[model samples]
Target: MHRGRLFRPTVFIIISCILFLQGLSAAPPLQTGSFIRDAEIEATLHEYITPLFRVAKLDPKSLNLYVIVNPEINASASIRYSIFINTGLLLESKTPEQVIGVLAHETGHIAGGHISRTEGAMGKATLAAMAAMALGTAAAIASNSSDAAMASILGGMSMAQGIVFHYSRGQEGTADSSGVHYLDDLKWSSRGLLEFMQMLEKQEYLSPDQQDVYMRTHPFSRDRVDFLKQHLKNSPYANNRLPQDFYEKYDRMIAKLSAYLEPPGKTLLTYRATDQSVKARYARAIAFYRENNFPEASKQLDGLIHEFPRDPYFHEIKGQFMFEQGRLDDALTSYKQAIEIKPDAPLIHLAYAQTLIEKNQPKMDKEAIHELRNVLKDEEENSFAWRLLAIAYGRGGNLGMSSLALAEEALANDKPKIALTQSKRSQYHLKSGPDKLRAADIQSLAERLVKEKE
Candidate 1:
């Protein structure tokens, strides 16, 4: 319930957002939608769901959570222990409890083995690819809500791919029942799920074309409502409310997303000038930045930083703003401050490393390489980090290490042939050492993968 952590921008990975996409063995790369990574949002979600996963006897570590940058009110669980949630659902939720409720339902799907029962028209690899395609790269840019919804939800594996990420009424009912039990066990209210269901009930009357993606996929029923209503009536924890502090955190999360993902004008309108709340000001600051009103944006951010100097996210965003504006020195200072506050955040380190690499100063290359290596420790398959590491190594005049990094990057990005070539180049340049051994290993793996393609 601690609301100390906050979101920072600039950790978007075309690959990391789809956590499983990088490890695909023989499958072709699928076009991915925009997925984002925010340390605070992901951490908050992890906090909310850890209990549910525990209650369900699911390994929290094995389960991956992804936030797709789409404005569709949908969430889905993959057969491979991954959960995908859209930004629209996060923004649409009235409270963190509502989000938790939905997540519990998804957890139910994972716990109940419903995902495996669903037809695998797409093989496990394809299914993983599809689930991953749901979120990746940047915010989804599809202009048409319907198309975007289907693409984001199904990862473009809709009817065209002969795949429907739907569940039967019975499965949904089981998930609802399981979700209710999980919440009840934790002494939390079931009202969040009930209210979310009731909210979707209205969409049932609409045509399939007009209905929200959740309705089309989840198959809502009055029986679901009646069952939840009955459970709430009898459960002792039925009236439980989330901590008041959580609501503020939830609002800040939503505000950050809206400021970054929504139209600048729309975000500004929603978080009006008169509303002096932290969340409101945060939204306005990002909106002003998006509008290119740097002065006003800096004013808002500076005020927030003055008030909350220790907040790493404030510094993180200030760094992002500065980096994007080509103010490398100012950006470096802010990013360094953010890292000083939250040293363990890999994404922030990744951003800082990227800025260091971009500054193009040889003296900083060593720092950039070190930071990139730290990022890879946490995110080994992060192709972006590998790519940045390659740049850092190249800048430091370590061609052998640079080639090895590029090979790693290529492997992560599913370009095994390129990996093979780069690994060979790396071996040619390096003497016998752990780095050379790594290059040899990459060569063998890449060669095998390339052969698998043939």
Candidate 2:
């Protein structure tokens, strides 16, 4: 989705709205933090959890999933109906079922209402603390590159570590049971969950610092392992096999992550040229690109495109490689191909819009603006898209709309002062209209938020 390697983490924060609107229909304050945003990976996650959510009688749309950029093997559910899964957990998982097991467990917590009961007493304090940290994270994101923002963002994560949803031992046991039950109801094996717990059991004797973040937060026990063991023995679906397509997708996901997250040299070594499997070729292509061996990367990617023309990800990654190398025309062609295959992916749309904007053709600015608006319709809080939209409007010679777009960008990035200034500027430059009226609303909201923070 970004200009970075495919499946790699891009640092960005979604900060809280400081004040909740007063009304019966007032929505809960959105949580704040840094995380990866990849359309392909997110779609895969949603696919894995859909049935789990359905079996648990929870609405999939009501729950949000975030892939935290941390390397700790952890997944946590917040009382606000969000699940945060660390990148380490995704990469470390050997099978889709293992990851599904974890999601099922988290869904158990959500369905059992464990999060609120455990976190209710500390809700206000946790919310206030995370909101305070949001300003620093947002500032770091605004001022730094992805790599530079890692430390500050992780520091922000550490500030709220182990406090958000520290479930009790009893709750953990209940979640285990519920998780396996959901898997069983779907006729999927819970063996993965049992295997995962057994792996955690070995860490029980390790010192606190030596244990994984999940162990520290989830409070693993031998009893939990035993519960899973006994359940597997009794459950009829314990040995059920997942679809072949699941493994294929899971393997590709892992290969893509390794190629992006691991060192280029390491990925090349792991997936050598002698290996011609789809996963190997995918990894090697990314590794070659990362190593700046464009010829080899091109060969691999071109082969992939020929072999699997319908696979949008291959085209998407090829587009990213071209986009990074400043081949706007080539990138645009690849991105358009990807979009044709997968029309609803917002990240791909964001990249396509970015490519159009970078072309700097006056005629193309309108097309860029159209793509950006569609992206915003899907992801209204995407500050990066808003920033691009501002640039597109500026290039189109629309100063008032450009200023209004900057106001929206600043608002999404939690820069109240900038939003206040830009909104006022937009109001002055534009004639009375819906957009000008929207600027007035932003100015009012920004004014209130600024005053409250002070």
Candidate 3:
């Protein structure tokens, strides 16, 4: 259950000993990436759990929910009330109703104050609460804003204090009841929940890492299913429930992403030379692209575009293929088509703008900057867009704005290409108008950061 990393959550002290024996780092980078395009799962959880919250006499409106793209099978209430689901669990779960069950259980953890009890009263502990300190909280903390809240969190500082786990038998029973009630309200079957619990209980017999991802953090047992079954048998709903759509979109996402995990040669072999199968053809296209078979990849994309016709993702892939071939104009056109179909998708706009910058066309400079600015609004931290925006501004003769954008890039990464661009632009504008000032600004910004880090 713990292989995905960071395993010492008070109840997981046993798992930690297993981790130590296995020679794995106790911590891994806290991930913030995930399947952001389709948020159906998170939104569904929010909708289904609302009734359960009311039944349990808790305010559902105040809690924030987030779907984080983590490979581990665990959910946690962050420092605040944000309920986070690892994308891995969503992709791996065999049934949609089972996911809803997981959501209900996590919500129970929240209402029961698992995170808050561990991390004393802070502000409105939102997933964004850490970042909110820089940008004021949308709502301040209610009762736990006092200093005593701080003491409680400090006491549970190590997260291994047996005192921190508040999920007693009573809370667990209540959570099961609320989960079944929520399922009944939605008219969806609750059998998936019990089945999932059974799987985790089986994992308890295996090695720690061999444990089902949920049990490491969720902690399961035989009693959980007994309680769930008791509720199921006692209810009139035992014979009544709605059919759930188990063909979850996340599964499709995983399938598409798996196109990357396959070996370049093996994936290519999976594709038929003919073009009937889009999925296989896509794997072939990816294989070729990774292998630097740009011309072949482009040809494959053309065939895919004709077959799928309306899939914007293929167009975006075509744009990438062209971009790598240095066919800037063609790449720009491909990306523009993708943007037309999915206008709100920032990656398409960013890709288009990046190609335009690479093209270094004077006429495209303004359009490139405009597109990048729009992308930044939705993705303030997209380092790639910042780099391209700097190029666009520099090409447009707006050296100051270019330098600011470059500064953002420098803040993101110290890629030599960006550094070289800044250096050259600074040289060209030395002691001149805004260019000189912009150059000086960039030099100061980059140098200051490097010095501070030193």
| Candidate number achieving the greatest lDDT relative to the actual structure | 1
lDDT of 2: 0.74
**Measured by C-alpha RMSD in angstroms, how accurate is candidate 2?**
8.4
Q: Looking at model 2, which ten-residue stretch has the lowest summed lDDT?
A: 18-27
Predicted candidate 3 versus true structure: per-residue lDDT over 167-229, tens digit per residue: 555566666666777677656567767876776776778887777555655556678889888
lDDT of each: 0.74, 0.74, 0.54
Which lDDT tens digits does candidate 2 get at residues 1-454?
2221111111223432211001001111122233555667778888889899999999887666777545778898875457888778888777888999999999999999886433343644343324332222122225533333334333445444434457889989999989998998899999888888877888899999999878977989888988888989998998898877888888887887677767778998999889999999998988887777889989999999999999998899888788767787999999999999999988888778877877779888899899988987766656667777778888777989999988987776567799999999999989999999989988988887688668
Measured against the true structure, the TM-scores of the candidates, in listed sequence, are: 0.84, 0.84, 0.57
* Candidate 3 C-alpha error for residue 378, in Å: 1.8
- lDDT for 373 in candidate 3 is 87
Better of 1 and 3 by lDDT: 1
- Alpha-carbon runs more than 4 Å astray in model 3: 1-72, 75-113, 116-195, 227-248, 265-281, 291-303, 406-454
Q: Top model by TM-score, which number?
A: 2
Q: Stretches of candidate 2 above 4 Å error?
A: 1-34, 116-164
What is the model-wide C-alpha lDDT for candidate 3?
0.54
Clashing pairs in 1: 35-136
